[model samples]
Target: MTETLLLIGILALFGVGLYGMMILHNFIKLVIALQILTKTAVLAFVIAGEMNGQIQLGQSLALTVIVADTMVAVVGLALAVQVRRHFGTLDIRALSTLKR
Candidate 1:
């Protein structure tokens, strides 16, 4: 079924994004991974509801998630900028090393 395939794709994207988040050392990379993971989760919710013929709750939740994700992305970018400024690099390891 298309629904099943959609679910699987969503799960794959979520896992891949998390993996990227874990392996990436750059602040920007982490932010991008977080965003991708979140959007995939949101997509899963919406897709699942559509498949089940009950879309109201999913749509409402997705709307809220979109708003939250937007705010989080803005804040995250600001934090990244600050990190770049303080350390002159976006690499988290380098930032940590600078503390010594």
Candidate 2:
């Protein structure tokens, strides 16, 4: 029963992340949406490992994912900052229409 609730929670989180990704246009918001999606994956991994009696492996993988996700967030935020500085806006559609 608890696992089922956890699974439902995970699904709800994933749905929220997906909705953010689809509806948001700002670079920073997009990065946050991506982070939300990544967290859902990490949770799923840990839960699956617990179910299979491989908690250590699952935890290690989740740690690795967290590390990678942090790097990605840093890079993404850096890019967003640069884009804002250059274009004076964070909207992805606005950036797309720029000319060299």
Candidate 3:
């Protein structure tokens, strides 16, 4: 029962993240969506470990993911800030237009 609920939650997070990625144009929001997707993967790892009797491995993987995700968020936000300062906007469409 608990596992089922967790799986459902993971699916929900993934869907929300996917939707955000598809519909949002702001870099910060895109980063947040990526974070949500990463978290969903982490939660799935933990849950799989719990079910397979390898909780330690699952936890280690989740830790690694968290570290990587943190770096990604930091870099993404930094880029967003730089883009805003240089281009005067955070919209992805505007940035793309400037590229051409």
Candidate 4:
């Protein structure tokens, strides 16, 4: 029962993240949406490991995912900063329009 609820929650989080990614035009918002999607995947992996009685494996994988996500976030922010420096805005549409 609890596992089912967790799965449902994960699905909801994925849906929200997908929606945010599709509807938001700002680079920062897209980054946040990606983070949310990453979290949903982490949660699903943890829940599956728990159900299979592989807690340690799940934890280690989750930790690895956290590290990878952190690295991705850092790189993404650096790129965003560079984009802002060169373009003066984080709006995706505006940036696209600048391409002549």
lDDT of 4 by residue, 36-60 (tens): 9888888887998999999989988
Better of 2 and 4 by lDDT: 2
Q: What is the lDDT, from 0 to 100, of the residue 11 in candidate 3?
A: 98
Each model's lDDT:
0.88, 0.95, 0.94, 0.88
lDDT by residue (41-60, candidate 2, tens digit) is 89999998998999999999
Alpha-carbon RMSD of each model: 1.9, 1.8, 1.4, 1.7
Write candidate 3's Cα lDDT for 49-81 as tens digits: 999999999999999999999999999999999
Best by TM-score: 3
Model 1 agreement with the true structure over 1-100: per-residue lDDT tens digits: 8888888899899999999999999898898999998899789779867977889988888888888988888998999999999889898898665667
Worst 10 residues of 4 by lDDT: 91-100
Question: Which pairs of residues collide in model 1?
Answer: none
Q: For each candidate, what TM-score against the reference? A: 0.89, 0.93, 0.93, 0.90
Order the numbered candidates by TM-score, best leading: 3, 2, 4, 1
Model 4 clash pairs are: none
TM-score, predicted candidate 1 vs. hidden true structure: 0.89
